[model samples]
Target: MKKFTYENITHAKELNIYLEQGNRVLGALGYTDHSGKHTAKVAMTAGKLLKKLGYDDHTVELARIAGYMHDLGNSINRASHAQTGALMAFQFLRSWGAPLEDIAIIISAIGQHDESNGTAVDPVSAALILADKSDVRRSRVRNTVPETFDKHDRVNYAALSSTLHVDVQKRIITLEVELDEGICFLMDYFEIFLQRLLMYKRAAEVLGLRFKMKANGSKIS
Candidate 1:
């Protein structure tokens, strides 16, 4: 087996451009934290999930990198961001000497991250989907003015804290969220995320884990 390291890539310029483009677009919409902060969290969480599940270190590292850049397609457009991001990631990974098989896995995972348009077809894809969708919290938008925060951002603002934990021993994936009603109601968050949560359920099923949720200390399904 060979190893592929993103550190050796000389395409930081292009990667930075992609990141900036996503930041700009999300900012224009007054979204709380769709940029690097959330993406970095997703990337790190994905790697952790794979690592805990006994995946190889190299594969875990690939998950980390894939999660970080999974939303690069949003730089072009939001409608089909995942699909476009897969192509972008594939091209860059190939240039970086990533093996063809690994490249395919990475690209597929990136393309299917959005539950609105994708399904978990592999372990990596399943892990990526769960990691990306689990990130929701009020800390992501504490800086945004209340008056300016839209419903999407307001839901994030209402979430005082959020954590996603995987219990490998119990084979359970749990999402715990603490919310503040002064900012937004819990129903608002569900209204936006129920579909995504359904996708997470499918992703968890692929990993043979039960998906559970606890919001404000109350069990949600």
Candidate 2:
């Protein structure tokens, strides 16, 4: 069995085109940037989440690999991107000579990252869930024309900065954000992200941690 590291997959060069094309597919549908920026953020955060909690190096690398490829299925269709993305990653990793055991973890993490049809299924999946959902920022809004922005776009655009921090010692994971209330109220954040927070709480629990949220300076969840 061969071992493939995150650095190897990220530097492959050939995979860059697929990630870019996947972003194009979402862009055509008026979605936020799910391209390199979003995927890279998820990959880094997922790997860090596991590493901070003392997961094995190989498992941490697997999380990063899964995070990077999670959105590729959006290239084919967004409706079932998680499921499709998992299959796509499986093929790519298998062809690249990744161990079948490692591929199993990566594909499972990719397949279950979406909130609509997925939950925290394991440590890696939970980490991916928390990491993917934590990335909310104004830069992710691809809809430049504010006049045409929807609730999702407006809320995301209102987020000036967002950070997900893990306090492993305290067994807590907190998502802190600074939002421009003039553009969108705190209520707007909850309106769109309440379900996400609930899901996040569940994910954190899987890692033996409590999930928290702070908007501006107040803890809301």
Candidate 3:
């Protein structure tokens, strides 16, 4: 059998439709952008994180695939999307004749990415959690009108810039964010992201690293 790669998944027309439809569904619900751009970023970040931690090339690639397909469940609905996406990815990868071992890892990561009922089950899953939660920026906000901004929208819009730094030697994964205070206070960020921050902490723990966050140049977690 041919070796399946992340490129295969990224270019697959069937998978792309699910990703596109998921973003559209989220947009209709006033959520931040969950489009291809976000998935691509998550994929890159997940791969980088695993690579920095000294994982093998195959494992790193699997992480990238998991990150890219993690949110496809949103195509059906936001609630339980993690579990839904995992099932969808399982069937999709199986159809492509991907190895059962690889499919297991990818599906596990996808199944546990949600904060509601998710934990860091493995390196790939932990990396996916960190990558997904750390994606916050003004560009993610689709609604231009301030009046229509909910807590999620305001917090995301206030994030002028965001970067995730992984230091293998120090064993630290830090999320540095430049938030625009004029749009929303730092407290608002916590109000909306406290669960995600807690999830990040656990995810970092699973990777044997420390999770830290700095918003507006001050460490918040």
lDDT of each: 0.82, 0.88, 0.92
Report RMSD (Å) for each prediction in the order shown: 2.5, 1.6, 1.2
Where model 2 places Cα greater than 4 Å from the true spot, the runs are 1-3
- Residue 137, model 1: lDDT of 75
Model 3: lowest-lDDT 10 consecutive positions: 1-10
Q: What pairs collide in candidate 1?
A: 138-159
Error of 3 at 148 (Å): 2.1
lDDT of 2 at 91: 85
Candidate 1 stretches greater than 4 Å from native:
1-3, 6-11
Q: For each candidate, how many residue pairs have backbone atoms clashing (under 3 Å)? A: 1, 0, 0
lDDT of 1 at 15: 80
Distance from true location, Cα of 170 in model 2, Å: 1.4
Q: Which stretches of candidate 3 lie over 4 Å from their true place?
A: none
Ranking by TM-score: 3, 2, 1
Instruction: Please provide, for model 2 over 1-221, each residue's C-alpha lDDT reduced to its tens digit, 9 standing for 90 to 100.
Output: 24477877877676777888889988899988987889889999999999999999888988898888888888789899999989988889889998889889888988988888888888988989989998999999999899989999999999999898899899999999999998999999999988788889889998999988899999887
Residue 78 alpha-carbon offset, candidate 1, angstroms: 1.2
